[model samples]
Target chain A: MPGYPPAALLLEDSMKTALRKKLLRDMLFARRFEEQCYQDYQVRKIGGFLHLYPGQEACAHGVMAAARPGEDYVITGYRDHVHALVCGVPAKEVMAELYGKATGSSGGFGGSMHIFDASKHFMGGYALVGGPFPLAAGLAKALKMQGRDEIAICFLGDAANNQGTFHETLNMASVWELPVLFICENNLYGIGTSIERSTAELDQYKRVAAYRIPAAQADGQDIEVVHEAAQIAVNHVREKGTPYFLELKTYRFRGHSMSDGGAYRSKEEVEEWRKKDPLEILLARMIEDGEITREEYDAWDEEILSEIEDEIVPFAENSPDPDPADLTRYVLVEDDPYVHGGPSKGGA
Target chain B: MPVMNIIQAVNSALDGALAADEDVFVFGEDVGRFGGVFRATDGLQAKHGENRVFDTPLSEAGIIGTAIGMAIYGLKPVPEIQFSDFIYPAFDQIVNEMAKFRYRSGGQYPCGVTVRTPFGGGIRGGHYHSQSPEAYFAHTAGLKVVVPSDPYTAKGLLLTAIDDPDPVIFLEPKRIYRAARAEVPEEPYRLPFAAAVDREGEHVSIITYGAVLHEAREAADLLAENDISAEIIDVRSLVPLDEETILASVRKTGRVVIVHEAARTCGYGAELAALIAEKALMHLEAPILRVTGYDTPFPYTLEQQYLPDALKIFEACETTVDF
Candidate 1:
């Protein structure tokens, strides 16, 4: 573990106490959200490919924590529930979207793969691998053109690091000095395939240095460490108005999704990572600093469960199935002017 | 008024549009400094600087996708694809994102962008460079497609495209870039979509657009020598096909010929031919004639035979006359 950074020691005193508590709360929320999605999938409540952001919670939390809400934009791939929630899309709507209800974000038309909230500055949950890279560059160009001191954060998996769009977008962004942060969430695997087996470059952060853009690596599991690294990258993007890259070294606790069995990696390897789980690390730090007593932690757990039971479960249950007639609604704006339900006309 | 070729008309129109509005910007390969391969953007980059008139990396997808983002950010981006054949790489963005943005987001997002690409095949540049992709875009909803035949209409329609509410796919005829010249207006004006009617004869209606329009006119002249007076109808707008003008011409002529350089199957001509059959069946004195490229892929060796020329138009017209 000498090569690996320590969780509690890696944090600043202020970040360790306050930020650690906040991260713990957010991570628990994300875990519960993923658990609910699994239950929903079993009962036939959710359909289509549902990629849970369970193990990748720290990257989302830390990156969003560093960005100013409504100023910066966040664009990520389909494994994006935590990214959306962390960027401030309401939990109920995120749940409803997966349930394919009229009240869901994108009016249930986008479902899990294409959740978008322009108001919250979560640009989209683009399904195409590396599609968001060029899109994020365009957004950064727009922001720069408007003279706004804002950076667009583009998140992709380590597997997407080899995609040509990533290189093209990064080169263009660097050349134009566009304000963007290209964060590669290296979960060590693309589905069941290991990074080393797929790509020649294990040190993905060095790829961005070729474009002369500033780059860094972070322990994506530790929220405090990620937050510090993100803050540095975000500041560089803001001050220099240039693209920055952060290679987030992380791991997935789940087997890609509900479909995959735990056949690819050994149970011992899973157990090893589970011991250094992001949630447990933050919870331990919060308890050690006396931020929350055991009683408080227990009460918070009860509160989250009840909130899920009363709000999420019922919302999923009572939410109307999308009207069959409205299937063609979000596909294109019709003569009647298609209006998505439960939100303002702005699709927030 | 000054007489100008298709290229000059386009260049003046773009310059005028840029001057008329501060938001209009041009970006594409060789569009800046090099002044575009067809010289459609000649001297504009020098006048507008690199910001307003610039060159993008040689990715058609990037040119279009970035233009969509720019349009969403409230800039009137008139992106150019170097050639019509090369526009396929960006087809997904155009058909999926740009065309559907206004409708998909429930009008929350409207991409008011224009794409200007040179299409059609009289030139010797085989498969990759010579293609008329107007029908592909016309098949898509939420897109206003235009292909002007002459200098005057090209200037007016280009301006209208730059100022239109939705995204416009302006397909310029590369084969006739400087082949024909006509007087173009110095002042800015818009020739409304579905509003190009030529009054020549009551014998036969020759309907066409883009490069084939000139050929249609020549065929009409040749028909006139044989005492066959043919009316020429220029379908300046493909998507919103000038139904009123087309129908009126059909009503008078009682015979029709639809000509286009795209393939014989599922081309823009098919739609016009179908419309005439549906709306003006009773008015027809003869069968509808369609002069178009063969169904096969555009070949390199038989390039001249592949293109629809004056002879093809005359042959189709002769059949209509015989009927």
Candidate 2:
């Protein structure tokens, strides 16, 4: 921001101001939302597993910022509230989803890890690492068939790099020239184990080039850096009808999940990463660019904090739970209209 | 109507599906150009072009996962896993992703792909190529597990599997791929996802599906030779478990002998036996008998011994009727 980055230069001053504010606010909203989720988890308001997306906000917000929502497909592993939020799924509904309320994106059927809104083109909250790779390829295949330039963004974890699907889907995506961006969120650690202990080759995108697909990595802590990388990946796949792999080098501020004791990593290492926190970096950049003063940054933080506290949480809490009868819904349907959960038959 | 083997009928059914719906396409290992290992999708790539029918990398997970993505994008993708034994690579996709898509989406998305895989023993494919894994798919809730006994049913059931608005695991008995023959209609005719009694009797009901049905028939013949009437119940569809038709047959027979080529432990035959014990136990003339493969893994050389043969089924039927 200090030296007029190329991405900012491509946009008008007003457009740049609007986008920068949007990116910062988007990242802040995600941070505040996940923080609220953490609080809710502590109070037992959020049940099951809770994976927060605080430090890696740039990966979600930046990639989604480069996306054409409602046209492109966005899929991610379990740490996915931010993906759903960035893709325009109602923040209140996402909160409701975590609360297991029927008003959630997946109607409470998908709690914490599984959130899908077809209307928003937010594909799914695949809880399995490397689970969404093939699906992302298929989504990109569908876009290719429909003659659309929209790409599918698949957010896989660093741990997922060793999965057979990681290699299988990447190979297929390359062979078929599918329009998918396999964004590996290399947050240094997978759950508790560091990447060095997990994957043999630490540079994931390098191995991805085995399939001959163009691959690169970005500083996922910097919003502008991530945005630039994602834009290149998105534009390349959208235009070339091929796949691109981007490894976002970032760190998770919190444990892999709520249950982790943070005993796996060192205090010094955590402190070092926290120093380059994406939110703080973006805030510093915005302040340095004269887009916002420190006072305005603090004020924006307050607004986002209140937005989640006063608005989203209450909506999620007040949301209804699903009926017992809807349990067998969406199994199979007749071809006439493609419906789900047919008339009740005598139970065996 | 033309007489064809299970492989031809399967190919015809795929061709029909491709012609019926432009959105329908078939992809798998050796499915295109080579027309599949068994030629089940034979001449399909040539007829339908490389796009509609194509070969895939020898990655079952990739094939199934790609089909899922295509299915979600409004396409009827029929992905073959080459052999059911080889489907383990794609198990995560089939079980975790495809099977759970619709229910997890709360009716927003339906995993409408038909996973056609050749399964069952007697092909001498050892552990890697020959195995009956229908129980694995049947045990899964959201998947439709169909094991056809003949060509007509194979074609019709494949058609139905493709048409069903959910994922289907079409387990073709590789043992009877070319062994079984029937006059499948040239034009596509939908088959009901219900059991059909190939041969009906009253004393001992030999319930089976896939390749084991042949053994069941031989056992029925053995019973006929002994002046015993055996009602052979072919379990056409495994998942929905046509308990009504099966129980009706069991009620008439008063005794049951379940037969399968899968391992005795947790095999589909156990489920069938449990179903009879649960719903129609009062009508049981004897403790229901299971003529099944050994608990050990399918052996390469000892397959003939490992798989349940006609003699084993016949002996079981005789024991059931005598008891």
- Listed per prediction, chain B TM-scores read 0.97, 0.98
Model 2 chain A is weakest, by summed lDDT over 10 consecutive residues, at: A338-347
Given candidate 2, what's the lDDT at residue B71? 95
Please identify model 1 stretches exceeding 4 Å from their true place: A1-13, A331-348, B1-323
As for candidate 1, its clashing pairs are A333-B103
lDDT of 1 by residue, B1-323 (tens): 79999999999999998888989999886687667767799899889888899866545677799999999888899999878887876989999999999898899888999999998876544445577788889999999999888899899999999988789999999888899799998888788877566547878888888888888888888888888888888889987777989999999989888888777767887798789889999998887877777654443324456566777777767777777
**Model 1's TM-score against the true structure:** 0.52
Clash pairs detected, candidate 2: B201-B231
The sequence of per-residue lDDT tens digits that candidate 2 reaches over residues B1-323 is 68999999998899999998999999876577656666788788888898999766545677789999999998999998766876887899999999999999998998899999888777544445567888888899899999899898999999999999899999998778888888889999899899999897979888899888988888789889999999998999998788998999988988887888777767887798788889998987787877776655554334566677788777777776776
lDDT of 1 by residue, A1-348 (tens): 022334554544347456666777878888888888888887777765567877778888888788885568999987888888888888888888777676776666567767888889989886556678999999999999999997899999987775568888989998898999998998887655566555777878877778988788888887777887787789889998888898888888887656556465788988887876888777787778788877877787788888988997788668886665543243243665533221011101
Position B91, candidate 1: lDDT: 87
List the global CA lDDT of all models: 0.79, 0.81
